[model samples]
Target: MDRHYQNLVQKLEEITHLNGVMSTLGWDQEVMMPAGASEARAKQIAALAGVIHERMTDPALGDCLNELKEKNFDHLNEVERCNIREALHSYELETKVPKRLVQELAELGSRGQGIWVIARQENKFSDFAPVLKRFLELKTEWAQRISPELKPYDANIDLFERGTTMDMITPIFECLKQELIPLIEAIQSQPLQPDTSFLQGRFALDKQEALARAISQDIGFNIAQGRIDVSVHPFCGGSHPTDVRITTRYKDSDFIESLYSVIHETGHALYEQGRPHELGDVPASESLTMGIHESQSLFWERMVAQSKPFCSHYFDTIRAAFPENLKSADVDSFYRAINTCKPDLIRVEADEVTYPLHVILRYEIEKGLFEGSMRVDDLPEIWNESMQKYLGIKPPSDTLGVLQDSHWSGGAFGYFPSYTLGAMYACQFYNTLLREQPDTKKNIASGNFAPIKVWLNEKIHRQGRLYTPQELVQRVTGEALNPDHFIGYLKTKYGEIYQLG
Candidate 1:
């Protein structure tokens, strides 16, 4: 039994290494690879996907799993048992999907992402529609193959967030929509709004980059272990804990966009860097889910960076970096500007109060696409209509509308929900953090994020996939996943900002 377990671990480690290589290649494609390399890169990704699929579905792994389960399952330690269980779950699912489909999807995703960049630049959805359609079709087919009993969309949702489904997410989104629409309407009706005009102007790209790098490190994203780069959309990806890579794009007109993106991606990098180092290339050391992963990013971006305490601590440094832009801005106004509640065209740049509505719109559209109620050709119109209906704003171009996000081009269906789910999870975890450490805000105000990072690492990061997201939430917060905590948080924070009585 021990021999079987060792062999299984060895195979799993090899797979993990291969997956890491794939991630590195993906990072290169997005950040470093030239436009002409798209075709070759797609083929490379396809071949690697085929190899990974073969290894994942290997019969030797199945044999090891079976022997361990039958012979010494009861004798295995908790970590060992967890690894075995997750490996088996993945093996079973991977075996059901064909290698051909896996390769096709991988290739399409690689090619589509490059095309998406070009199409977005040109503001033409028509150029990317065919790839988008084929990617969706392949993903739907892949989902059906793996989970025949589930609705195709539900199966895709499970790919990113295990155990989550439309039935589970719909009610939460509906609750948010019900509560948020009136709040937004009220805020919009206010006679006075923060003058964020100071945030808009020419700022040197090098200065912005320097400021972002300094702030990310100050917040505990280790510069020695990770790096920051430029990409069309900001993201954090790396081969391992010690090699994390994060990227953020700069806008000379607005430093806030680049700065917040760095903060958000740093949140992700910190989680990657904080995973238990001893448990290398194993399931137990992996992130629990996309929702959990998103929670880490949002926790910093919204719960910390957007807070008054953070603004108070960091305003001087920021103003010093861009003296002309922020010379007249005080901490209070800076906090309000960062937390401004307004509808926006870009989902990534949307204010917190209106952000979830953007996600909900994407969720609805994804649901519609998989359910056969929507089509690729209809996306721009549908997106525009939904934006108007939800936020009382309509996008004038496809780039700002359907093409704003890179998720679909990369075959990331059912991923948008993770953002909102993560926001809720972050709130729950943060509320617990505050309860345990009453000085959390003070710590932020003093620019001492060590306590916050240490707490998160101890409570969330090191555990890895040792617990399901639901179980982890319960263990950390002493309650089930609840939307009320998130809703209450929004009301309390934004109410004070908008003076809603």
Candidate 2:
């Protein structure tokens, strides 16, 4: 390799390490940092963001990239080729935007998160409105600056998942909404739902934490490299391929909150740990889009963790976790309780059958928010309307409605669609997995995820940014992104739960 390209790769590695640091600090702020450290953390992050932006957009970096653009440059391997392509793409997008804008957005996003934390607690949108509006303005400007050829919204969506656009997403979302609304209504009228009484009671934190650790181990998350903590909003974040950290929220009166969330966050940690040792130029260390990442967590959380076979195998472990509370609880009863088909205000807590409806509602509003059809201040009213339209219930406060998610507050405008996209990815992957290994359910039921995780690592996680989400889905599933798979999954699963006659 030419010294130019070599230097570029080294610089990129440095940038990635810096990014890992930022991730660590961000994770700490959420899980372990004292409340008074918010301001310092924001500035620290802003500085890191500025440094990263400078490195990414440097003229020398652009020159090295231009030099390496030739096909024969240094006889570039596939890894180098991918790195150059993605790096150039990132460079073009970042350099076009002003550094001030980059720093400004970072600072704004940090402050906005703080405001969101407060506003959600207060259940008042007014406290968050001004920063939210500022965030949108900055985001719109940043999007416009990056790709003047495309609409700001489409450009923004492309950031999370490559080549994804409002036009492409709109039809898919339409199909999802069309199917989900009636299905939810029908399921709502059904009588054969799971009894969730087993999930409610005073679940001790120690037991829940112990259960979380055991399940995390079962699912291949290394407890030594990763640790679980409690937080207001559950998430998994960390600095490097090793040293992964995740958080889950607990309700002493509710078990489901911590139970499934641990599984979901563990999905993220496993993927992170599974990243290849070769860093920088290799696509393996690079995570796929947020949507694809979510699919990993959700697949483990819903497709495996919540499956009937799995519950039976682990019922005794679960009972042991809440031995006193679940003295009379059994696998079947626990299964019915967790899969209970009921509408709820919180999206995270919604039953699997009604989950996509929540996604549909957010997708519509997100589209509206991006297209200037929706204003930040009007979000609460619109959220209530969509909640009623989709879920047959309304949130009494914005806290349970639009303010529930930290995505928008963090200046992530085009990320909401990924939740449903992840579900769709999960369905296609799950179907393909069943076909590939008929014993997948059997293995999961036995609390062994090694074989499945290995398959996913080789076929999916290992590919990482080497493939776009579209290519990843097609390659793994032998099919394109199909909502039919997801719909079928819901119908089959819910059919059993609701006994649709």
Candidate 3:
């Protein structure tokens, strides 16, 4: 190994340790921290961010990277070469923004999260607007500093999923809007609908937790290494892959929210757990992109957990969880209730048929915000209008409208598209998985996910950041991201449920 490369690797390890600390703090802030501790936590996060920024932008790190790039690399392996390449990319992007700005952004993110929670609870968008406006201002400035060539929104998008742009995403979404509107209308016009009454009964939280945990464990989430808890919003975050933490809020009247939140986040934990263990110390070992990461989660939540075979396999468990309520419920009705399509206010709770519409709504609003056509104060109105136009429902309050999501408060512009993109990717990947493993449905029906997990690990999980999202898609499915697979999946699945032609 070259001396400079070794130094670079060592530096990255230090930076990763700091990141681990920051992630721990973040998880604590969301799940366990007292309200009185918010201010101190914000300062701690900001100081850590400043130190990380200084280290990442250090001129010596640049010199080391340049030395490695300038020297002969004939002796190095692929991972070594990738490390230097990824490090150079990170250094360039991080150096663009000033350290002070980075610290300010981190501080604001922490403070904004607390404010957003309060505002949403109170149904008051005004309470959070000023903080959100400041966040947008900082994010826009940071985007400009990073790359003036790329549009401000695209610059932020690249941070999550590189090689993606509005030019590419716009048409894909337009295609979805064209196909889905008619499909939704057709379903609504149907004479018969699924019996969702079985799902409206009181479900015990302890039983829900047990079911969630059982399913999470059955799908390869190592409980010994991971823990599940409740949060205001469900999320998966941990300091290390070995210490994976997942959270889902429970509602006594609804169980799917907690059950599927576990399944969805377990998919994320699986990807995090399956990351190349050999390269754990390198930044290259992290999941490649947010889109790819979301694909894993959506795969489990939609393609696996929501499938007929899965329902057949797990019906008894669900029935047992609520014996009094589900006494009359059968597997078919249970499946339909779980897959029922109702255009709703919440994105996280949306059914598969209407899920992408939620993402599309956010995508358009984000475009307006970044393009200067939309103002912060107008978000609530725009949100209500879009809901009425796209989903045929209007949010009566900001709590269920503009204040519903926690992304903007955290300054995560251009991140919503990943959810829809991931759904498409998951569908395409499922097509190939079924083709390669003919007994996959049988295995899933029999409570055997080893085959499914093994296949995903071989095809997607172990690759880590070695390939971009597009490259990985091509390598696995032999094509670029095709939304037709997702549309076809929805059409076929819903056609069976609603008897649509």
Candidate 4:
């Protein structure tokens, strides 16, 4: 390799290492760090952020990238060229934003997370709103730095999902709002409701954890490389593909919650594990977008784990885990129970039929907030109002409402739409998998995930960031992203479950 290529790769590796350390620190903060270490963690994260920013914005790196972009650059293969191009794009984006802003955001996020935990537990929005406002202000400034010509919300969305814009998503969300509410109303009008009473009783935390781990393993999570742990909020993160870590919070009253959380996070781990190993630390080797990443989690958590076939296959293990709680409930009842459609205050716990509404609410709130029509102080009241308007339910407190998600606490604006977008992607991908391998449901029913995992790894996970999400969707499904796939899936699945037309 030429000197320019070599230097670029070396610099990229160093930047990747710094990011890996940040990921590890982030994991620790969420999973293992003591509450008292908040201040130290904030400084550590800020220092790392400053170092990474310096490295990313270095003049030497810029020179290397400029040289790589010169005439006759085609000596390198397509993948290498793509990596270089992506690296340059990232470097330019990073250079546009001041290092001070980056450090401030990092520190604020670290400190805000601890405060968020306390504020959530104490059910006090007042304690957390200031930090949230400050984070938003800093993030807005960062977005402006990255793309002053773009709308702030679109610029923020670009950070998590490149090539997506509020204009593209708004109409999709509008279509969903137009269709989903009526579909939900039709389902509610039905006399036959899926019985969910069997899921109400207490299930031991230890047993729940064990069952979650076992299911995650059975579905192809590599325990040697990855492990599950408890956290205030469930998430998946790691320094490298070979060292994945996932966490889930348990509720004694709801085994399904933890189990699905594990499944969801395991999906994320699977994607990381399946990434192309040959690419090493190059940014192009990372997962494509947050939307695609969420697609993986939702694919497992809903399409597989919540499916009737999977329930039939896995019900025995669940029954064995909590015999007392589930003895009288058969697989069919349990499936219906798990799939029951009802509007809920909590987004994570929302049933599939109503989950998109939760995302839509957040997406709209973000659009309003970034567009300057909404203020941070009004989040609680507006959140409650939106919940009532969208889901026909209201949170009793900010903890159960405006403060529910960890995204805003970490300055993850424009991230909520990914959940619903992921659901759409999952539906499209699942349809493709079924068409390609007709026996997928049968294999899942038989507790054989080898084919499913292989399909996903080959089709989606292994590609990494080689393609934009839209390009990937078109290549995989012969169609671009269309919410119709998700809407159709929801209607068909829930129609059968609710006996609605």
Per-candidate local distance difference test: 0.93, 0.83, 0.91, 0.89
The candidate that wins on lDDT is 1
Candidate 4 weakest lDDT stretch, 10 residues: 71-80
Off by over 4 Å in 2: 71-74, 279-284
Taking every candidate in turn, the Cα RMSD to the unseen true structure, in Å, is 0.9, 1.6, 0.8, 1.0
Query: Which lDDT value does model 1 have at 78?
Result: 77
lDDT of 1 by residue, 299-351 (tens): 99999999999999999999999898988999999999888999999999998
Candidate 3 Cα deviation (angstroms), residue 353: 1.0
Count residue pairs with overlapping backbones in model 2.
3
lDDT of 2 by residue, 274-363 (tens): 877565433336888988988999899989988998998899988877878778778777887788778899989987777877877877
Q: If both were scored by lDDT, which would come out higher, candidate 1 or candidate 4?
A: 1
TM-score of each: 0.99, 0.97, 0.99, 0.98
> Please, what are the lDDT tens digits per residue for candidate 4 over residues 1-501?
788888888999899888989999999999889889999999999999999999999999998899888847768876687688799899989999998899999999998888898999999999999997897788889888889999998999988888889889998888999998998888778887877777888899999988998889999999999879988899999998898999999988988888998999999999999988678788778888899999999999999999999999989989998888888899889998898888998989898888988998999889998888999899999999988888778999988998888998889898888888899999999999999999999999999999999999999988877788999999888898877788888888888887774
Which stretches in model 4 have alpha-carbon errors above 4 Å? none
List runs of model 1 lying over 4 Å from the truth.
Answer: none
Give candidate 4's TM-score: 0.98
Q: Candidate 4: lDDT of 347? A: 89
For candidate 4, give the lDDT of residue 113: 89
